[model samples]
Target: MPERIRFLRERAAMQERARLLDGLVERERSRLESLAQGNASAAMPLLDLYSDSALSEAAGLPLPSILGAPADSRAVDDRWAAARFCMSLLRGRKDLYARFPYALSEAADKNTFLAWLQSDEGARSTGLTPASQMHVVGLFSGDFAARARQAFLADARIRQVLPHGLTPAGQHGLFGWFMQHVWSETETHLRREEVLWLFMQAAENPRMELARAYEFTPDWQRRFPDALTVFGWPEFASWFVRHYGADPRWVDVAVAPEWHEPALQLRIGYGARGAWSTKYPLALSDVGQARALIGWLGSPEGDAGLSATARQWCQALDLPAVASELLKPGVNIIGHFCYPSGLRVSVESIAEALGQAGVDTSLRDLRTDAKDDPHHVDFGGPEVHDITVIHTQPDPFFPESYARSDLAERTPRTYRIAYWYWEFDSIPDAWVDCAKQVDEVWTATEFIARGLRERLPIPVRTLFPGVRLTPFEVRKRSDFGLDEDRYTFLFTFHMMSVMERKNPLGLIRAFRDAFRKDDKVSLVLKTSFGDRHPAELQKLRDAAADSNITVIDQVFSPDEVLSLMNACDAYVSLHRSEGLGLTMAEAMLMGKPVIATNFSGNVDFMDDGNSLLVPYELVKLGKPIPPYDADLEWAAPSVEHAAQLMRRVYDDQAWAREIGARAKASAEANLSLEAAGRRIRARLEEIEALRRQGR
Candidate 1:
C-alpha cells in the first residue's frame, strides 16, 4: 500500500477506537445513575458489573447514593445486606476505606458486622481471607484512640500472622500488608529476627523480578546499611547479579570482592558501548558505573575481553578529559535541513557563516520526510562533533530527534544548545518547561532573547543569523505574468504561519486604499500551503477581487523566489509579529527598498534611514491562535499610515533608489556572514572559559 493511504487508514482506526471508549464511559455513567436512584436489591446486580479500574478514570462517575444511604433497620437480613454493600464499595475506593470506621460507628448493627468481619464464612463471601485480616482490622480501628490502636497491633493473634518471608507467588505477602497498615503505630512491634528473615527472603528470592526487588533494596539499605555483609556477600552478590547485572546501579556492590568476577563477565557480554549500538548505555550516565568501567578496562581480565579502540574510549571517561573534548571548535547543527521553511534558512545561513570563519561545522537533518525541493543544496562535514546546536522550536522538541540522528552516540559528551525563535510577547509554560532540557538558548533577535531570559534560568543570548543570497539571473516582469509597465510591490508568506498574525488582509486593504484597479501599479501576493488552509486562502482571494492585486499561491524553488523578488520594484510585509524577518532582509540585500512594520524582529536591521517603517498599536490577542496563547500581545499595523507610505515610495523614484542603497548597506553591516560568524565564535570562546573556571 502507498504511504498516504496507510496513514489515512491508521487515522480512521484511531478515531473509531476513541468513539468506542467514549461509548463505554457513557454506558458506565448511565448504569451508575440508575444505581444511585434505585433500591438496595436493584443496586446489587448493577454493582457486580462495575469496572473499578476502567470506570474510575478521568471520566469516572461519582460515588453512588448507596454510600450515603440511611442506616439499615434492626432486621438481621437487612443488616447483612448493608454490610456487604459497604464491602463491595471498598474494592477500589481508597477514599471510603479511610473513613470506614465512621461509617461502621453510624451503623446500628456495628457488633453484628464486626463479628461477621472475622468469620470464615464472611471471608469466603467478600474474598478477604485470613491473609488480609490485618488490613480489615486497621480500617475498623481508624476511629480508636491512639492507645487503643497500639494495643490492637500488639495483640498475640496479630503477632502470629506477622509475615516473615515472601509468599509462594513471589509477592511481598503479609509483611507488605503489615508495613502499609500498622508500621507507623509501633515500629517495635516486629521482632528483630522476623525483620531479618523478611529482608533475607527479599534479597534472595529467585522468582522476584528486577522491578519488584528495587522496592525492597532502598528500604533494606536505609534500615541496615551493612545488609550485604549480614546476608553473606557472595550469596547476595550472586542473586543480585542474576537479576540486576545490566542495571547501572550494580555499582552499589562494586566494593565487594565477589562483585569483581561477575562484573567483568557482564561487561564482556555487553561488549563496547558505542554509537553503533541501538540502546543508549545507562552506565555512562551514572558516575560510579562510569568510573568503575574505566578502572576495569585497565585491568588484565578486562584487557582480554575488549579491543584496543574500545579500551581507549572507555579510559576517556574521566571528567576532565570529557570536558576538554567538549571545548573543541567543531559543531553539529541539527534541524530540518532539507525543508523549505524559515528554520531551514536560518540553519543554512548559520552553517555558512561558521564555515567562512574557519570553524568546523556539520549539518544533521532531523526530518526524514522533507518535501522534495529541486533547489536543495547539501552542506557536508564530519558526522559527529563536540557541540550540537538544535534549531527546532521548543513546543515540538523531542530528545528522540537527537537519538535518531548520527549525533546520539556523542550526545553524552556534547554541549547542547537550543537555537529557538518565538513571535509572541510571552511563551507557553509547557514550551518553557521543554526549553529547560538544554544547557543554554540562543535566539536570532533581542525580542526573543528578552522573553526567554525572563522565563529561562539558563543562559539566553541574542545572535543574529547571517543572510547571504546566491546571485540569480533576473527575470523580466512579463515572464512572471506581471504587467511590464506597472510598478509592482511584492509580499510573500506561508499559510501555515497563522493568517491572523501575517495580516495579509490588512495589507490588501492598505494596497486598495493606495491605488485603484485602473492605476499603473500592482500588488503581487506570493504564498503557499493554501491547499491545507482553503478557508483562509478563499478569504484572501475574495478580498483581492476586482483589484490590481494578483495572488500566486504555488511552491517555488529558492532561485525562482529570489528572481521573483528581483523582478519587482519593492518588498513589503505588514506582519503583526516575526521571530526574525528573513525575506525582508533578503530583499534589502538585493538593494530593494523594503516597507515593513516598525515592530518585532525586523526592527533589528530596519530603520527610518533605510526602510519605510509603518507605525502600529500593540493589542491583546483576544482569541488564541494555536501555538500562541490568547493573553499574549502582538502588533496591529495602521493601514492608513501604510497606504500613505506606499504612495510616497511609488511617486518619488529617485528617493526610493537612495533608500534602497541605504537598506543594502545596513543589511551588509549587521546581517552579513562575517558579522554572524564573529558573534558565534566569541560566545563559544566565553563558554569554554566558563568551563575552565568550573562555574
Candidate 2:
C-alpha cells in the first residue's frame, strides 16, 4: 500500500516486456524453416483447394494443403517481419530492466507476454511461424532477490502488515539495509512459534491451557520501553501469546475482540510436553534450581533412571529417593518454584528435613539463636552438608570476609560450592580460593565465558540470563496516537537507574541532530519522567525543540506500545551495546525492524538483513567501556555513525518500513519464544547436572 511497494510492483511489469520479445524472435525462425521445406497447410484444406468445386482436389500446397504456409517466399517474408518486431520489443525490455531493479514472477511475467503477442499485429501476422531468436547485442538486465526475500517476507502476516515492498519507494539507502538484514535472518528461520503452558501445583489442578490469538508486531525501537518491560512477567506472556495467537483452549473463557482480533497464526512448540508449574511465587531460574535438586534424589528402588550426579542433588535437598516408578504417571511441574527477594523458608526446616532424613548435620545450628521464630521459616538451621549457589550478577555479592568469614567462624569445611564466580571483581583470587575448595563454574554470555576461561583453570559454558517474555495485548493505532503517519522512534530510558546500560546523553544528542535535520520526524522517549528532564534531560529537550522535533512521553500498557509501533513507520536503538537486548528481539517479533549497535548478544538476533547497524561511539571512566553495566558505571557501546542512518529513516518512510519488516523476520526466525525457551531448557539441564555433583 505504501508508495515504494507500488513502484516495485510496477517496475516488475516493465521489466517483463523484454521477455515477450524473446518469444517473438523464436517464432520467426520456425516460420522461415517451414517455408524452406515447402509446406502449405490450414484447417479444412478444401477451402483453399478448389473453392466449392474442388470437392476432392488438392493444391500443390506443398503437396499438402495439409499445412498452411507456402514452403515458399511467403513464409520467408513472414519470418523477416517477425524477427524485426521481436528485436524492437527486446530492445525496450532490456533498457528498462537495466535501469531499475524490482520483483517479477517469471511464470506470471511469461503469461502476460503471451497476451501482448496476440494484440500486436506485427507479432500475430507472422502466422503459422515460430518466433526466431533475436541477437540484440546491447540489452540490460538486473537481478532482484525474489526467492530469498520471499522466503521471509511473502508470508500472510507480512503481506498484511506491509502489503507491498516499502523499501523501494523511499530512501533507496534504507531499503538496501532492510533487504540485507531480512535476507540473512530469513535464511536462518525455519519455523515461527509461541508456546504458552499453564503450570500450577498438581493439588491446585494442573492443566495445559493454550492461547488463541496473535499479531504481526513491530520492532523494539519502534515500541515504547514500558511496552517492552511489561513483557518481563509470565502472566503478561501467557495473555499476549493467547490473544495474539490461536486459542489452544477448548472454549475461550475470556474473549475480547478489541484484544483478540486474529492478526497472526499461532504455532505450538515443545511445550506440548508439560512440566509441573511448581506453584511457587518466584523466577523460573530459581525453580530450575529446585528441579535440579529434585533430580538429584535417586529412585525409591534406590536406583531410578537418573544419572549419578542427579542422585547427588536429590540427596542435598534431603528429598526421598525417586519413587520406584521412573516417571510420575500423571504429574507435571510447571510453576512450583517461586523465590522473590531471595529464597524463602528458615534454616530450621532445612536442618530438620536433613536431620530427619539421616543426612549429616553437625556444622550449622543457627536454630539456637534463631530470633526469626521456629515456624516463621527463617529460623536457624542445623549443620548442612554442601551448598551449591549460583551467581546472577556480574560482580561478587561480598568480600572474601563476607563470603567465607561467616561460614568459617562457625561451620564445617565441606565442599561449599560456587558456580560462575566472575561476579567477583577479583575473580582470579576468588577462582583460586574456590577451586581449592569448591567445584564447577558458570558464565552467562560468550563475552563472560571467554573472560572466565582465560583466568580460571575450569571450563565455562555460555549460559543465558533467565528471562520469560510477556506478550502484548492488541489495541488501536489511535489508542496511543501520534497525530501524524510519521515514523515513531522508541527508547526505554530508565529515568536514572544505575543498573541499566543505555546511553542517555549520547542518545539525546544524536536524536536531536537526526530529527532537527528534518521536520517531519518524531522521537518518543518512554521514561518515568514525562519529558521533565532533570537539567540533563532538559538540555536534550531544548536541542530537539530548537530543531523542530516532536517529543512524546506517556504512561501506557504494553499493548499501547504495540499499537504505536504498528502505526509508526520505523524503529531506532542506535545504542552502543547490549547483552541480548531482549527489546531488540521483541521489536522484530512485532514485525518492526530495528537499528542497533553491533555488539553483544544483540548479534544473536540482530543482523544487517533484519536490522540497521549504527556506529556507537561514547567515552566513560577514562577508557572504552562495554555495553553491559554492573559496577558504578555502564555505557551502551556507542555509534558515531547514527546521524546519517537516522536521517534516512526520518526522511524516507518506505525505506524505514522495509528495514522494519526485515527485522521482524529475523526475530521470528531465530529468537522466537520457542527457540529461546529450548536454549533455556538446555542450560537448565547443565546447571542441574553441575549442582547435583556438589550435592
Candidate 3:
C-alpha cells in the first residue's frame, strides 16, 4: 500500500516537471522573437526568466518534474533544458543585432515595397552553408547496392562514400525514398561540405538584407541521375525565395511537396550534368547575345576597406552565430583569376606571360572533363603555385579529346586551381587525378570552400572568383541627343534573344515611381531580353509609359558604356547575385554613384557610404511555370523602393555628387584592376616562398 502511494506521487511529479520545461521553451522562444524585433520590453523579462531557469537547471533542482525523482539521472531532461537555453538565446533580438549589426537598414534606402523586414537587415556575416539544409537523401534510397553493381558507376567510386540507408528490399521497393531522407542538401552545396564553408556563404547572402522565402526539393533517388543531387541549386533557390522573392517560381520548384515514389531517378544516368550547368556568375551573363567585347582594363581601388536566407533552410540550417570580424579581413584576398578558358592562352603562353611579369608561376592543365575524350582540355606549362586557376563555367568544347592529351601528366607540384560555383560534388574525373599533384583549391567563395571539405576527399580554401574591370567606352550625351547638364540616371534593363537576370521590370517600376514624384531626374537604360518573356518586357514598357526614359536594348562597346556611365549622374545594377558584381564595381570606378541589390560577389564591393545599398523584398508568383516547378515568393529591394533611393539621390544633387566622388575613390583604392593584377603577382611569389618553406 505504501509503495503504491509513493509510485503515484512520483508519476505526478514527472508530469509537473514536463509542464515546467515546456513553459521554459515557450518563454525562451518569445524572448528571442521579441529581441529580433528590437522589442526590449517583451524580451527583457523573458531574458531574465530564462537566466533564472538556466541557473536553476544548472543546479539540477526545481528541475521539471518530468525528469523524475532522480533529477540528475534523466538523459532526456537535459535535451529539453538545453533546447530551452540555446533556442531562446538564438531568438534574442539584441543578440541578433549584436551578431548581425549590419543587417539593419531603412526601408526608403531599399526602394521597393517588397523590402519589409530586410529594410532593417544589411550586409552582415552570411554564407552558403549558413542557409543550407542538410537533407540526407542518398542513404535511404534502396537501390544503392544495385547501382554499385553497375559497370558504368563502379569506376566513379561514389557508392563507397555516400551517407545514407535504404529499405530492406535492397532498393527494389522504393528507390531514393523521400522518407529515406538522411540530411538536407539545402544546408550546403550539393557537394559534401564542412560547416565553415557553408557558414561563409550564408554569412555573405544575408548581409545584404534581401528577402527570399524557402523551398524544398523532393526527389526519388534511383541509382542514376535523380540520385545525383546538387545541394547548391536548392540552397540558391531557397535564398532567392528569402532574399529576392521578386519572382515566384522558386518556391514551387524548391519547396518540395510530400515525397512520392521514384520521381527523379535519371540524374546520373544521363552522365555528367555539367553540360546543363548554369554560368558561374549566373546573374551577369545573358544567354544568346553576343557581347561586344570591351578592351580597357580597369584600375584598382585605393586603401580604405571594411567589413561585410533561406528557408526553413534559414531555420533548419541556422549556422551558429558567426563572428562578424571573420567576414572583415585586415587585407582581403583580391586578384585576377585566369580561368582555364580560351585555347589562345596555352599553358606555355601562360608561362611566358608569368615570366614576363617577373613572377615564377608553374602550370598544369587537366582535361576539363573526362566524360568526352574529344573535348578533353589539358593545361600544362608554367605551373603556378598559390594563385587559383579560374576554371570558367564548364565548356562542352573543352579540349580533352586528343589522344595526345596529357594535361594531368604535365601538372606541376605545389600549384592549385579553384572549382567554379557549380563544380562541387561532380568534379571531372581528370581533375580528381590532378588534385593529388596540386596543393589547394579556392572553391568559389570561402563558403563553398568549407562546404566542399565535407563532400570532397581533398582540401579546399575559400578563394572567391572576381570579375575584371577596364574602362568602358564613354558614350557622350550627344550620342543620345540628351542635355549633358541634366542629372541623368543610367539604367540598364532590357530583353533580347538571350535571358539575363537583370530585372527590367524592376528598373521600369523604380524609374516610373521616382520620376512621377520628382521631375528633375531622367533615365537612360541599356536593355535587352528574350522572346519568351514578352509579358515581362511589355509590362516593363507599360510602367514607363509616363516617364522620360530612354531604353536601348543593344550591345554597346565598353568604351561607349563607360563614357555613358561616367556622363550619367549615377548608375544602378540591381541584380540578385552576379556571383561577383562587376558592373557595379566598374561603375563605382568610373565615379558614378551606384545602387545594387545585395547578393553574390557584388556584396564584396558595396559598403557603408561608398554607394547606396538596397534591401531585397520577397515577391510571389501564383502560377507554376516551365524551368520552375511551382510558384515561389522571394525578397529583395523592390522597384517601388528602388525609386525611393533614386529620389534621394536625384533630389540631393550635391549629396549625389558627393556620393559619386566617394564611389569612385572607394573602387579605385579597393577594387581596381591594377590593384588586383599586383595582388595576383604577389600571390605567386608568396606561394613560391611558402613552397620553399615546405609549407
| Cα distance off (Å), candidate 1, residue 298 | 18
- Total clashing pairs for each candidate: 0, 84, 145
Tens digits of per-residue lDDT for model 2, 1-695: 69999999868855654353344334433433443454323111112111212311221112112222222212333332333333233333554223321212123234333333444452454332332212111110111222233232223223222211221111111122233222222335321100000000000110111111111122211221111111111333343323222222422332222221110000000011012223221112243433442442334444234334334434543222222111111101101011111111112222233333333233221111111111211111111122322232223322241221112211233223233422212234444555544444544446446656666665556544332234556555345555465556766543432212455456556766665444666666554444434664555456556543444544444445456555655566654444346556656766665777776556655667888886543334344233223342223444446666777776776877788788766665654434433453454345445655644
lDDT, candidate 3, 1-695, per-residue tens? 99999999989976875575455445545544554565545422111212435423332334232122221111213322222222233234455534543331222243231132223331122111211111111111122112111211112221221111011111111112111121123423121112111222223233121111010011111111222223233443343233322233413434333221111211111122332222111111222210110000011231111111112222232122211211111111111122222121223233343444454332333333322211111122211122435342323322322111221211122254444443122334444444553355544344334434655675575433233344455566878667666678786533421122556556667777677634666777775432446776566567666677776645454455556667778887766334345557767876778987755455666776888887785454344432222343333466766888888988877987788789888776775434444554565556655654762
In candidate 2, stretches whose alpha carbon ends up further than 4 angstroms from where it belongs are: 1-391, 394-444, 456-459, 465-469, 476-478, 496-501, 516-518, 529-568, 616-620, 623-640, 683-695
Give each model's whole-structure lDDT.
Answer: 0.61, 0.36, 0.39
Scanning candidate 2 in windows of ten residues, the lowest lDDT window is 193-202
lDDT winner among the candidates?
1
| Candidate whose TM-score is highest | 1
- Model 3 lDDT, residue 334, Cα: 12
Give lDDT: candidate 1, residue 583: 94
Alpha-carbon RMSD to native, per candidate? 24.3, 29.3, 28.8
